[model samples]
Target: MPISHQKALPSPIRVVLLNKPFQVLCQFNDEQGRQTLADFIHEPDIYAAGRLDRDSEGLLLLTNHGPLQHRLAEPSQKMPKTYWAQVEGDITEQALQQLQHGVQLKDGLTRPAKSQKIAPPKLWERNPPVRFRQNIPTSWLSLTITEGRNRQVRRMTAAVGFPTLRLIRVQIGPWKLTSLQPGESRDISGDPQIATLLKSPKRKSYRSPRSPQR
Candidate 1:
């Protein structure tokens, strides 16, 4: 049978969903020799869709589909990702509004994004909790954006005077961090809506997606 004549699989090839834990670098290797997805995802050829900082935690998607991977990681496409941030002080309504409008960063003004205070989400225990100051208070804020600027979440919080102490990604496009706890993972069959967004043309002034650290 000709290659084009072969029957297609029942579904799109599956993508790996990893609840990337804190302190695990995004790359396969580190000069400091820390763990990475390679420690868990032994499957070959697949690459990370986007990046989650070593200090940050939560959903990180991986896949072998090149076009889909490029679309997800590409800044031009602006696929929204949601993150839950634990900051060092109470978050005010004004601060959330400022975030939604846009904030000035050293690089430039960030694009408008969504942000709101959220009740502390019940999460799996981190191996080591964030440090405490005897008098300092904290709050949780849920933020979502299409652009994945480097350290953008931390920078955005700091720009508004609430430095983030912990960050967890709760959603990527249509996929959520639901059910999959820290250090656990599952396979996503695929979603057509997300695929449509991925296939769209790259936006002007979009920063090209770089390969994940590893």
Candidate 2:
């Protein structure tokens, strides 16, 4: 009789969605002793798929799978990310149009973005609240972009005459921040659909069907 051999099943992928708080470094370690993802997340094997600036806040994804991480973080993938920005003035329609078309930056002209004026979101108050100017009124915007250039959102708003005062990412690709408060995280490793998607040989690019309204 011939001996039978069987291949072992692959380990389940681990993915974590975290609502990163303002002022926390995106990395796990900080030489300056500043707060980092390590302060909140204890998973040793997982790493941030992409990064948010230390001053920016909201949804950040981490994963243990290298391919999944690359798919999410690579700028060439053109994954859309939605952000809620509180700008320094009553943003104008012209500004929104400019943003929707394209904005010139030092690097190059940015790709066209989906831009709209929106009401201020009901959100957790920041510890060091945004500076308030009694004379100047501020407005909010919901902007979605597919690029990952450094400070792209802030620069885009500033180029159109409204500097971003407070920026919060609300969604990335198909993942929504939802109700997760600052510093809170959820593990989505058991999602069978995500597992299957990761394993698919002919996977399509992930894109949001429509721009996020808020």
Candidate 3:
């Protein structure tokens, strides 16, 4: 019998997760020489699926597949992103309800979201720790929303009278920031479970689109 030759399969698309640190820019390059993604990640040809503000810290997904990146980043896809936020006030039930029901912002009324009180998440200290106010107490809340409007989370908290002191993204779609310290990165390649979740159709938003009044 003749020897059989088999071609090697190409590597599946790579998905990199980084526990983005506070004050770090989300891009690979910055003209001002500020800390950027290149300071922590050195992967070739991979780009962030979405961006994290310098003031926010936590899970940031990067990938090589353009379509997959768009699916994750596009707001229209409506993937829920979860965050643990430490707000200045001891959040009241009414405020939590307000956050859940959506508050009116300068831009417009936001879609209803999931919000609840939670114990502060265990994590590494921020390089410049959040200010501690001796007289005012702070509380933690877990907020999940399907939109990614610029500074939306901060604005939402402020609108409800509980200004966020610290915000950390804990989950996005099928990925998480658990156990990954600040500035650390992990490769979640070849995980079929996550791939399925990523490729799954977007979850329909609970709220119906407002109909125009005649």
The top-ranked prediction according to lDDT is 2
lDDT of 1 at 70: 78
- The list of candidate 3 runs beyond 4 A from truth reads 1-11, 197-214
TM-score of 2: 0.87
Backbone clashes, candidate 3:
0
lDDT of 2 by residue, 1-214 (tens): 9977978887668999999999999999989999999999998889998889999999999998899888788766777999999999999999999999988887678889999999889999997999978999999999999878788899999999999999999999888899999999999887675665567564355423332221
Per-residue lDDT tens digits for candidate 3, residues 17-135, read 99999999999999999999999999898999988899999999998888788878877778899999999989999999998998888667788899999987677878788998899
Clashing pairs in 1: 27-214, 28-214
Q: Whole-model Cα lDDT per candidate?
A: 0.84, 0.89, 0.86
Score candidate 2 by lDDT.
Answer: 0.89
Report the lDDT tens digits of candidate 1 across residue range 111-183: 8889999999898888798986789999999999888788999999999999999999989988899988777
Clashes of 2: 0
- Candidate scoring better on lDDT of 2 and 3: 2
Considering only N, C-alpha and C atoms within 3 Å, which residue pairs clash in candidate 2?
none
